[model samples]
Target chain A: MQKEENKIQAVIQINDLKKSFGTNEVLRNFNLQLNEGENIVVLGKSGSGKSVLIKCIIGLIKPDSGSIKVFGEEVTDLSHDNLDKMRVKVGFLFQSNALYDSMTVRENLEFPLRRHWVQKGKENVNDLIIEALKNVGLAETIDMMPSELSGGMRKRIALARTLILKPKIILYDEPTSGLDPITGKEISRLMLDIQKKYNTSSIIISHDMNCVKITANRIILLIDGTCYASGTYDELKKSSDSKIKQFFD
Target chain B: MKSTILKDFLSETGDLTRFTMSFFREAFRPRYEFSEFLKQCYVIGNKTLPLVGITGFIMGLVITIQSHPSLKAFGAESWLPSVVSVSLVREIIPVITALICAGKIGSSIGAELGSMKVTEQIDAMEVSGTNPFKYLVVTRVFAATLILPILVVLSDAISLYGAYLGINLKQVVSFDLFTNQIFEKLTFSDVLPSIIKSYFFGFCIGIIGCFKGFYTINGTQGVGRSANSAVVTATFVVFIIDLMAAQIADIFQIT
Candidate 1:
């Protein structure tokens, strides 16, 4: 009964999802569930379909078959407008940060607010931008452009932009791919702080074991177009299976 | 191999048609992007004036100087102003201005959007609950369509002035006589069709550039390809449209 209740509390659920580009099958019969306030790390190799999985969840790439349910709503069934509304609740942080290069950091953060038609007084909007930047330790960088920021700073600004909406769920793709060890660890710790502060669920795609250790409450290992194994960072590290052992070693 | 090329061509045509239809459908919806539209007009209209003006002036002067000797041989030197004015108003100025814009504006839009696409900025906009198509494409296309006619009108007037100067170099003709000769020869038939066709030219440039840029792939290299193809395709479309416009005017006995 407790397990069944846990399943009901899932913020995101995917089952038997299949997606392919031409003959190159990226995901086949993939399944996963993310419950409320939990950070699930999707660990995989470079071409192991981690990004594809995130794209499918956000409806950027449609699955060939199967279902994706967000808060008990079928994602595939929603119209364009409804899908856009759903995007408001699901924030996605791209690997490249994808900040509008023409705009300042403040404008980039305000984009989601204006986009979703969240009406607020000018003072309130400024407060929201400042609060988001402060959360990412970037309150000083608001007037700067994305080009002027360092890689780590750009990533933080992107996170602040994503957090500005206070999304119920955040999907991060390769959050620590290009950063140095110290910067990567900082980002991972920041991820934890945000999760604690907002109680938001997240599915983070990464190959960095340190990031997985820091941010993951649970980890899903994607290999050969399927979820090969899943457990806590310690649980997976202790597995006797050769494929699972390779990651820990 | 030929078949594959044909298939690709057909696919692109279909996609362009669908893109154009979507632009029309979303353009009339509520919450129109008025400020962005104004910004685009300012950029598209105001920025191109210097280039268009220079090109129009040169076109008028050269056509008048080159054709003067021929008209003089036929003892029709007085016909020089009317001939140059009619040609400039009906075809040369609008076509040249559009081709210049194709090179300038089309490539710029393509590169800008292509870079945005490769960097995932367009996807980010969409995922942020914003309408990227309505915000980016519609405003640009609308600006191009509305602004090109005004540009052509301005270019025609400048070119006529250049022709007046060209005539003065050869023989003494008053500014009033030259102006009278131009207005007398240039009719509504000559003026309206040229203006009408320029709007289509602008639409083609804006839409083709957006389409190429929006669908960019293969990363940075794709950005270069999109920008290059946008100018080439836009310039080609200008010629095709001009040909069709000329034919339609001929059929209607307007030219």
Candidate 2:
């Protein structure tokens, strides 16, 4: 148990993040700190830079100023190759699921593995793919095309893909946006289950209230690019402020 | 009416010039997306084959049927195979195939990539650390450049079948005699220059389509406009390139 004391803190840390596209600034002085095993839910309206914020975290978008550190390595000014190297520890779930439509699910799963040249020595990729699918409750679909899968099923396949790298942090962009309530609940539960099993930190971008209630260890409410409110659900619920109270009651 | 006409002319010209600059800038940038390149080959080369083949067959048959009476009147009906073969190999097939590709490949590429841009998929890729140009542009251009020549070669051979059939409509020419006459007139100059020009046709098609789609803005309306303009301009450019190549080859022959 003494080994727990020496464990590193803050798996991800961001300071005063800023970005602008033309005359419009999207993210303004956003700051966040996430512990090694915490699940932080960020809430925002559409086009409020929720996706943009996640993109920045994964090195997809460049923030104008400020610092971002993943696993204590500064990521603001990494070179192309170095940035890709950093991405090895990050698993991102895109909103559209973005599975290559022309390729089958097996090919989709095998893409990064082939690109990065991973090998399990002719034992077949079936076990690994099945295990990933099983984790997301989609074990029966390894050969289906993306076109054949329902939307919720596609999202699960995407989630399974995100788990392939066994990331230190999982960044979900609107993980349940288009899903029906029942399917959405399954996905939310799946995320919590995956986090607990892997003991990894998660930063989920969601505006779904029930999702916020079910998943957040802490909530970061974003308005105009900065945190508008920060607290636990219980603390947030007990508060008197109209904005924070309105979210729960 | 004059002002409207002037405005239309300016818009077209500005689009052409802007397209040129964007392609040049993107070409020099760092990210090289190799996977997108392979995907382009699959899309451009494989997908367009059925259309190219059908069009080429019809083209061959029509050329043979039309050239018959004129040659027969000259008492050079025996020369029908050679004449049609030479013309097909030297000009018609390559130009026609390229124009067809401009319609098929050029429009689809513009639409697909244009939609991706409008829907923020390109931005998603950029954020994902994938260089959209190497993945998107180079693959497409390389596919078009390589595939067009193969399509032209296939079309050339089939069109000759058309010429032979055309001669047999009034006069019988054996397969052996037809083949002999065709190669006799099919000089290295004719074949080489024709195939060489097609690579340029492919490049113009690919570059114009990619340029239009990559930089598209507005929304759905913009995507439709981009796709339409890409085909029209790419077709226009292909003909111009063919003319220039013909002129240059002629100069080479004289010099």
TM-score of chain A of each: 0.97, 0.93
Q: Largest DockQ belongs to which candidate?
A: 1
Which candidate achieves the best lDDT against the true structure? 1
Task: Summarize candidate 2's per-residue lDDT along B24-68 as a digit string, tens digits.
Answer: 676667555556667777878787787777777777778888888
Off by over 4 Å in 1: A116-118
Worst 10-residue lDDT window, candidate 2 chain A: A114-123
How does each model score on TM-score?
0.97, 0.86
lDDT of 2 at B232: 92
Model 2 TM-score? 0.86
* Model 2 C-alpha lDDT versus the unseen true structure: 0.82
Residue-wise C-alpha lDDT for candidate 1, range B1-255, written one tens digit per residue: 999999999999999999999999999996688988999999988889999999999999999999999999999999999999999999999999999999988998899899999999998988888789998899998998888889999999999889988898899999999988888988999999999999999999999999999999999999999999999999999999999998999999997
